[model samples]
Target: MLKGKTALVTGSTSGIGLDMAEALAREGANIMLNGLGDATEIEATRAGLEKRTGVKVSFMGANLMKADACADLVAATQKEFGTLDILINNAGMQFVSPIEEFPVEKWDAIMALNLSAPFHTIRAALPAMKDAGWGRIINTGSAHSLVASPFKSAYVAAKHGLAGLTKTVALEAAEHGITCNTICPGYVSTELVDAQIADTAKARGMTEKEVIQKVILEAQPTREFVTVEQISGLAVFLCSDAAASMTGVILPIDGGWTAH
Candidate 1:
């Protein structure tokens, strides 16, 4: 459905971002992946996706922590693809700490990646989207975007800010044949979440499974981590013609995490 479309997915070297890229590519969209990873591995990934999907696939390890770099990322993709049909703001970093104990640097880092990076990319990409008269802006929010979690003040705050940003943009672009939405997901078993499990176990003084059950999955009624493919599939749907009327939507795939 995305044939001839060009999509730039930030933080796509691994995990959900990677899955998002692959899913879009499978739908015939040209992919421009951005994130951090070993040089050779990223290249191999880039090459392999191109071969498998028979679509042009490129990679740039833009440091999304910087606002200017985010603009440069959008510019580079525009230069390569001639148009930016879909923008996936999936780049993010997490730091777990109580508000008082949270390091100032960590707070800045989380806010920069989780919140500010999307702002930069969206601002830069909007004019083009407006000119094209069609665009899809998908922000990767989390359950934290809707609810709070203890000792995760920075993450929660940034995600909440992101939700507001997504809604605002959607309203502004509602008449432009452009749609903006945030996908709020529950915990997914990615490397980032895996590392957090250990930290949470130590912090909560519980075993890994206990942390998984009592901590991570505590509020999730399904007791199951969301799948990367599931998110990617939803992303595809949002970019489809069927979703033309859906904008400013905070669609959650949280396994009922916010039901309470």
Candidate 2:
């Protein structure tokens, strides 16, 4: 479905971003994987995805916390593929702490990676997408984008801003045949979440299972973690011809957390 097209999925070395990249590749889109990972691992992943899917795969190692790096990533993608049809802003991080105790540096880091990085990438990729007269931009938002929780101030703020940005870009790009949307997911069993669960268990003197049940799964009706495949499938749908009319929308795969 996406033959001859190119996709850039940020923070795609692993987790949901990796799943999104693989899904797009399977649809015949050339893939550009971005993230901070070990050098050998990054190259191996690129080679493996290219070999398995029979789609060209490239890598852009950019520290997305810096705007210049974000711009360079777009430049590198355009250099490698000539044109970009899909942009998945999946690069983000979270810092949990009481608002009063949150470190200023951590707040800045979260905002830069989660919110500002997307802005830089969209700004750089929009002109090409507009020139091509077709594009899909998917921002990887969180369940926090719709609802609030304690101790995640920076993450919540960045995701809310990302949803707003997605809407604005969708409106502006509507006439140009480009659609922008946000995919808000519930807690997934990623390395990030694994670390958080471990920390929670240690902090509260609870087992990992107890922490997951009482804290992570409490807000979810399914009492289960959302899978990366589920989120990536939605991304694939959003990038399809069938979804051309869908823009400025925030689709939540949060297991009814947002519904209630």
> How high is each candidate's TM-score?
0.98, 0.97
Residue-by-residue lDDT tens digits, candidate 2, 86-138: 99999888776778888999999999999999999999999999999999999
Tens-place lDDT per residue, model 1, 97-125, is 66777899999999999999999999999
Q: Which lDDT values do the candidates have, in the order given?
A: 0.94, 0.93
Once superposed on the true structure, which residue ranges of model 2 sit more than 4 Å away at CA?
202-206
Task: Supply the global lDDT for candidate 2.
Answer: 0.93
RMSD to the native, candidate 2? 1.2
lDDT at position 33, candidate 1: 94
